[model samples]
Target chain A: MIELLLILCIVAAIIAIESKNLLSSIISLGGVGFSLAIIMLFLSAPDVAFVQILVEVVMLIILIRATINRDVTEVKCKREFFGMIFGMALVTVLLGILLMGIQTLPEFGTALVNASAESVPAKYYIENGLAQTGSANIVTGVLLDYRAYDTLGEATVLFTAIIGAIAILRKKKTNE
Target chain B: MNILPLFVTIPLAGAFVVSLFDFIKDEKKKNISTNIFASLAGLVLLVISIKVIGSAGVYSMGKWKLPEGIVLVLDPFSGPILLITNLISFICILFSFDYMSGYNGREKYYSLFFLMVAGMNGLVLTGDIFNLYVFLEIASVASYALVGFGTMREEIEATFKYMVLSSVATAFMLLGVAFIYGFTFNLNMVSVAKALGSMEAPVGVYVALGLFIIGFSIKSALIPFHAWLPDAHPSAPAPISAMLSSVVIKTVGMYSLIRICYVVFGMNTGQVPEVLRVLGILSMMLGVLLALGQWDFKRLLAYHSVSQMGYIALGFGLGTPLGVIGGIYHLLNHSVFKSLLFLNSGAVYYRTGTRDLKEMGGLGKKMPVTGATSMIASMSIAGIPPFNGFWSKLIIIMACIKSSHPWLAFWAVLGSILTLASFLKVQRYGFLGKVKDSLRNVKEAPFMMQVSMITLALLCLAMGGLMLPGLYDLIFVPAAGIILDQAQYLKLVLGN
Candidate 1:
């Protein structure tokens, strides 16, 4: 089931990238996001899945709004066949290298018992997180208590993005 | 007191306050409040950085132990970077006091500026890889917005290009981090290093390293991955340009690259050094060659930034004690002079409303302060004796020769000489000749702007003195020592 969902995600991503119309591409992107959210659920990360779905919906709406009154068709430029071939070849090489590298990695769900896994930070967090942070949910404890600074930094990123959008899109008043 | 968290908190709180100032309605009140908040945040950070110098500690969040919690490590590596980030940011904020007035959304500008500062400070100080990525995004996103702050066509285009390229880079970096996590089951630097150090070499490690190199090379605007820099740097307002060129690339790009390569991956052995040296030389030559043809004032300086960063990369690539020192010192020196140069360009644009070098001449007579400071900056960047740039460039070249790479040294020398020639062109065309009729009435930059420029110019002059034994030991030595002896860093953070 997860494999099928993953394949669906990939297909949606390719469609999103290849679609000529901006709206359909965006909708395909939504399709990709939804499949990703479902895969997250299969992985037992329901919190991530929930957030992913919410963000995907918000993003789809935003993209739709942006496309309104704009040219829906992506302008097709002169295709550089050589460049395309070169890019594809490079991608193939990189993918091959990455796959070779991944072959040596521990299989999924088995990493916790791997030789060096005793020292992994997540193990410590899982065991002591609730006690350390007074939160029953270990994830919250990790995010809010043990790694609160990361949360702070993440908040700042969101704030910065908002400020940036406002800085870019705010209507200018002419009078001094 | 644990002042580590405050570094990220104050500017964030200040950003929040400045955003609320949007409701104040009175522009003057809004402006004053924003200024006060920015200055206060800057002042506090400046003082804290000064207070924390020469000290190193780990502040684990929520009172959790190091292995269990996110830690902010204040080591020698972070000390100089934090100091430079705060000092330059404070100066840039001062310059922006007057320089940013013409732009709309003053509050939004300050808010994003402080957030960028917060992001950089966090990036410098964070000891966790994932945490670093989050902060890196914060800084990158804020800069993307700030780069397009003008809302002009070129600015928007540049911002879009920058955003796309940077997002790709970020994606690559995240993939690399994922690989690292899969390999070591750790996100903390010390833990990852420990795990990787104890294990046999894995193919995954090399792959992760490659991704990190490509990702950070883009961030640092190194030769191959530097497409976004020249466009993005010049499109932003002057102070933002200064910040982006001077510190942003260094902190997120070079510093992280160095830390990951040396401390995390252990740089003493491998093809990494050779790759770094080759990339460095390529960037050095290409950046200067590209810079020589540019006539736009800020654009020229942007290209020079890439060229100078090459020198830093070359120094680090050597992987000797002296090489590390040279690289770190060059990083510091470049931030000072490059920022001063950008501010000088900004002042010129402020007065004459033109960045075209050909349109301005004899501005030396009218704007003596701007011209003089710019001359100082130009000389500094050109590596003339007695300025900061000369010392660092000399050390890097000397390190090159000492490392038995005379060809690299030769390339370094040629790059510097070419840099001098182009800057002489800048001096001759932009400041020395006949003033265009339209620019005849141009005045010197305003007081706040002049003060910031002068202070930075003086800093350029004074930075050479940092090579003195006492100051060198105080500042650059420990910083370089951290990278040179990766074990020391691991021990310092993990207390093994």
Candidate 2:
């Protein structure tokens, strides 16, 4: 089942990248996101799946808005043959290196330990997260209490994006 | 008392307040209120940073232990960077008081500026790798908007390019973080270091390191990944340009790269330093070569930023004690003088409504302050003796020769000479020649702008004093020491 979902994701991603029509590409991208979220759900990460779905929806809307009334169908595929070859070679080398590195990882779902031979932080968080943060949802507890600084930074990113959009899109006032 | 959280919180709260000022119908009230709040916030940060110097501790959130909660670490390494970040930010905000008035949306501008500042401060102080990424994105996103704030064709185009490239870099960084977490089961820097230190690095770890290096190299605007900087830096408003060129790249790029390479991966004597050295040389030679041909005043400075960053990278990549000191010192000096140069260019833009050096000349008589400050900055950056740049460059070159890499030292000297030539062009064509008719009536920058520029210029002069043993021990020595001894960081953050 995971293999099927993974293949679906790959197909959708390829379709999204290769589709000439902007709208179709966006829909294909949405397909990829939906499949990925399902995969997350299967992995027993409902919170991640939920966030992924919501983000996918928002992204689709944004892509739609950006593409609306635009002649993006003209999609110029200017292939620089040398550049393409170089890119392919680089990707191949990177993947080769990455594959070699992956061999050293511990087998999947194994109990991981720190250098001190103690259980990793995840074990501690799982056992004590609720008591420490007073939140029922461990994810929320972790995000808001245990790691609220990261949340603050995330909020700042969102705020910056909004302000940046407004700063860029606002019509200039001439009274000054 | 845990004052660490305030470093992230105060600027964030200031950003929120500045955003609220958008409701004010009166422009004067809005402007004055936002400026005061932002500057006050900056002043508070500066004070806190100064107080935190020479102190190293970890502040875990919600009273949770380090292994269970996100922590903010204030080691000797983070100390100097934090100080530089806040000090430059405060001065930039003060400078922008008069400089930013020409642009629209002053309220949103200050809001985004503070947001960027918060992100950078958090990035500098955070002990978790994932937390660093979050803050990195915050700062990068804000800068993207700031770059395109003008809404002009070039500004929008540059912002779009910067956004795409930077987002790709961030994505790579996230993947690298995931790789580390998958293997080590740890997200905190100290924990990750502790984990990796115990065992031989596997393939996954190497891949993760590669991703991090590429991501950070892109962020730092090192050669081959630096195409976005020339376009993005020159298109933004002057203060934003100064901040981006001076603090943003260093904090997000070089600082993080150094932290990961030295602390987490522990590449003290290996292939990593050699890669860094090669990249550094490439950036230094290529950056200046590219810079020598630029005609736009700000664009020229932007290219020079890449070149100067090369020097910093080379200094650190030498993997020697003196090299690290030189790198850290050069980072500080570059922030002072490079921002001064950009601000000088902005002053020229403000007065004559042009950034084309070929179009203006003989402005020395009209704007003595800008001219004098620009000259100081130019000399400092060109590695003239008695200036801050000279001392740092000398140390770096000496470190290079000592490390048995005389070729790198020679490249360093050549880069400096080319830098001098480029600035001489700036001085000759932009400030010293016959004044064009349109620029004849141009006046000096406003009082606040002059104050900031002169303050930074004095900083450039005074920073030379940092080379003295007394101040060196106080500032760069600790930072360099931290880089040299990663075990100290691990012990400090996660006590044995």
Candidate 3:
């Protein structure tokens, strides 16, 4: 069941990327998110499903709002056939690799995080995270306690993006 | 407090403090304080980097154990890079003092500059692959903003193009990092190196390595992935052009690529060096060929950046002790001279308000300082005797011959000769002829700009000394040693 949903997600994502028109691409992207949420729920991860649904809905609405009263038609360019063929070839190669990787994984529902899986990092985190960090949630302990520096870097990246938007979008002249 | 974190923290705090001054109503006051803070931050980082040379340590973040947490390692490899990034960035700040007077929002400029510095500092220092990606984004995004900071139509267009390509590269890098994690289940470079050494790696790991190479090649503006650099470098303000062309590409692009290939994946006995050599020679020839036709001063230099990076790559491709040393020595030399050349161009632009080669002639007589410094720069770039560019190029060429790839040596020498021809064009037509009517009244660049140029020019002369036996052992040997031996790096980071 999860494999079917994941395939659906990949197909929708491909459509989202390959679509020329903005509106179709946006809808295809929504298809990806919705199927992903379904897969999450099926995998017994309702918390992730809930968050994904909420975020996907909000994102789709925002994209639709931005698309209103604008031309969804893409500007056609010359030599697009070769470009499309090239892009398709790349996608096919990447997807082939993805499928190969998937074939080698453990059983679909096996919990690597909690399983006694030969001393993987995730298993170590699951076992010792609560004891060392004093957090009941392993995710919180890993994110905030162990790899908080990465969170700092992530926050800085966000801050830089905001600065970029401001720098790019600012008015030419300031009010005296 | 170990000094590793301060390399990043100083710049981050400085950027924030500079941005806070944006609220100041008086432009002059705001500019003064921001510039002062940015310069001081650069100075402090430079001093600390200098102090840490030849020292190695691992600073674990949040006091967590090695495998579970983030670590910033300062070894012989990263210490010099930290020095160059800070040193060149410090000079750029000085150059911007006068050059940016015409532009508005000095506060925004300095803030973004420091942020870019902070990002690069973290990128160079971090041992975790995922953290490297995060910091790479910070540096890249800040650079995109800086590229378009002028908000001119051309600048904005170039920024958009550069941003698109670089975003793609960063995505490739992140995907590559994900693959590394999946295969080895390790984030730390030392640990990942250990894991990959023990395990029989799958096909996916090689693909991930391919992805990593492509990502960094794009960042460094190698031959095939080099379209955005010519546009982006010229479109940026001069100080920024200097930074992007000089240290930014080296740190985020080639440095990451080398670190991953050597420490994590192991470079010996692979087809990787063969591939890099081909790319290097291709970039060398094509970059110079494309540069030979350019009329725009900055664009021509931008193209040569592609060519110079090729030499460094080719040196690495040789995979010998002399080859790697030549690669690294050229890396330092290229950083100084390229930044100087850009500063010279920026100084020219400041005085004359033009970037076209045809618009200016014989201004050398009028603007003696800019003329002289640029002439020094041109000579250094063209590989004249006693100048820094000549030595590195000679070393690289010799390494090629020593490696028995005399054809590669032939190509290196040919590339250097073509480089000379193009720079001679710059000198003859752009600087040394009759001063054009429009440029008649042009004077030397502002004092601050001259200081920056002269400092770099002096570096171009003195760097030849670095090749001497005394400094060679202290600096070049260990850097090459680290790049060659993964075990030494592992022991440095994760001691037995």
Candidate 4:
């Protein structure tokens, strides 16, 4: 089932990448996101999937708004050969990096831990997270209680992004 | 006292509040209120930072133990950096009183400036690796917007280029943090360091370190990764340029690199210092060499920033006590003179409305204050004796030779001479030659601008006093000790 969902993701991703029309490309990107959200649901991460779908819906609206009235079908730049070569190079480099990364990760569900290690933090999180944070959801416990500082930092990053967008897009004096 | 969060909080709150002033219907009233309020916020941070200097402790957020929640650490090492960060930030806000007024959305400029400050302060103070990455993004994002604040074609283009490259660096950093988390299941740096030290780290750990070094090298604008800086720095409004070139790169780039390499990974990480040395030498030679040909004054100074970060890198690259001292010393001195130089260029542009060196001439007579300050900054950056730059460069070169990397010392000397020549061009062409017919009516910068320049110029001279044992022992020596002694740092944070 996971394999089927992942293959769907791949197909949509490819469609998105290959689409000539901007609207179709964006829609295909939405296809990839919706399938990934479904995959998250199957993987027992409902909260992430729910957030994913919400974000996907909003992103689709914004992107579609950006593309609707534009010359969606016209190809702007004539760089097919160069683009193809660069894309191929990027794929090769990414594959190399993936292989290198895979070598360091543990086999499937087992913990990525030193085999000789006595302990890991997950054990404490599982046993005490409920009592300590009073949240039945361990993910919430982790994000909001134990690692709340990171959550605040992430929020600040978003704030910075909003201000940055406004700063860049604000109306300038007419002299220019 | 758990005052660490204030370093991040005060400026962030200041940003939020200052942004509110955008709605004020009265133009002059709004400008006066926002600028005064921002400067006061900056002054408060400066006062608190000065009060907090030389103080060392770790404060865990929410009273949570290390390895469980976030922590902020201030030690002998981070103290002076913290001081300088606030000091320069306040001065930049003071300088921007007039400089940023020409642009629209002056309220947003002050807001973004505070955000950048908050980000850098949080970055320098945070003890968790992931938290550091978050703060890194905050600072980088703010800087990107600030760089393009003017909305001119070149400003937007520079911002886009900067944003793209900086995003790449951010990806590298996040991946590095992820790799570390996978290895240790820890986000707190002390815990990660402890875990890795005990485990006999694998290839992945080294890979993570490599990623971090590369990411930071790009941030620091080392030679090969430095295409964005000359454009971004010169395109920014003058105060933002001063902030970016002075504290932003050092705090977010070089400081992070040093912390990860020395305190977290330790010498056993292998090849870290050597990599730093090679990169340092390259940035030093190539940056100065690159600067020699630029006709724009600010662009030339921006290139010099890249070169001088090389000097700091070389100082730390040696892994000697004296080397660390030299690195910290140079870091302090560069912030002083470089910002002064940028403000000088800003004044020139403010008066004559051009950055072309060929367009400038001996309006040194018209703008004596700017001319004199630029001269002092030029001399200091060129390593003239009795100035702060001379002491730091002398220490760096001495350390290079003392470390028995005599060839590196030779390259260091050559970089300095090239730097001297480059600034000579800046002085001779931009200020000292016969007054140009076009610029004859140009006047000096405004009162506040002169105050900023004169204040920084005074700092450039007074920073030489830092070499005296009194101040040296008080600041740089112990700062170097914290950087050099990994065990003490871990102990300081973790209370081993």
- Which candidate ranks first by TM-score, i.e. highest? 1
Regions more than 4 Å wrong, model 1:
A73-79, A114-118, A173-176
Runs in model 3 deviating more than 4 A are A14-21, A38-79, A94-119, A173-176
- Give stretches of model 4 more than 4 Å off: A1-4, A80-94, A112-120, A174-176
**All DockQ scores:** 0.66, 0.63, 0.44, 0.53
On the 0 to 100 scale, the lDDT of residue B50 in model 2 is 89
Expressed as tens digits, the lDDT of each residue in B1-496 for candidate 1 is 3999899888888888888778888877778778888888899999999899889988887776666677889989889889999999999999998888777688898889888898899889988899999999999999999999999889999999999999999999999999999988888898888888899978988999999999999999999899999999999999999999999999999999998888888865568988899899999999999999999999999999999999999999999888889999999999999999999999998888889998889998899999999999999998999999999999999999998999999999999999999999999998998877888788989999999999999999999999999988988788888887888898888777
| lDDT per residue (tens digit) for residues A35-123 in model 4 | 99999999789999999999999999988887788765644666689879998998898568646865785555576334321245555
Indicate the residue-level lDDT of A138 in model 2. 88
Q: What is the TM-score of each candidate against the true structure?
A: 0.97, 0.97, 0.94, 0.96
**RMSD, one per candidate, in order:** 1.7, 1.9, 2.5, 2.2
Clashes per candidate, residues 3 or more apart or on different chains: 0, 3, 1, 0
Q: What TM-score should be assigned to candidate 3? A: 0.94
Instruction: Locate the minimum summed-lDDT window of 10 residues in model 2 chain A.
Output: A110-119
TM-score of chain B of each: 0.99, 0.99, 0.99, 0.99
Candidate with the larger DockQ of 2 and 4: 2
Per-residue accuracy of model 1 over A1-176 as CA lDDT, tens digit each = 98898899899899987777788899999999999998899888888899999999999999899986786467477778999999999999989989988987888668677443257778776676677668888877777877787887777778788778877889983122
Task: Give the per-residue lDDT digits (tens) of candidate 2, residues B1-496.
Answer: 2899899899889888888888888878888888898899899999999899878888887776776678888988888889989999998999889877777688899989988998999889988899999999989999999999888789899999999999989999998998898888888888788788887778789899999999999999999899899999999999999999999999999999999888778886677878888889999999999999999999999999999999999999999989999999899999999999999998888888889988889988789999999999999999998999999999999999999999999999999999999999999998897777888689999999999999999999999998888888877777777788887887788776
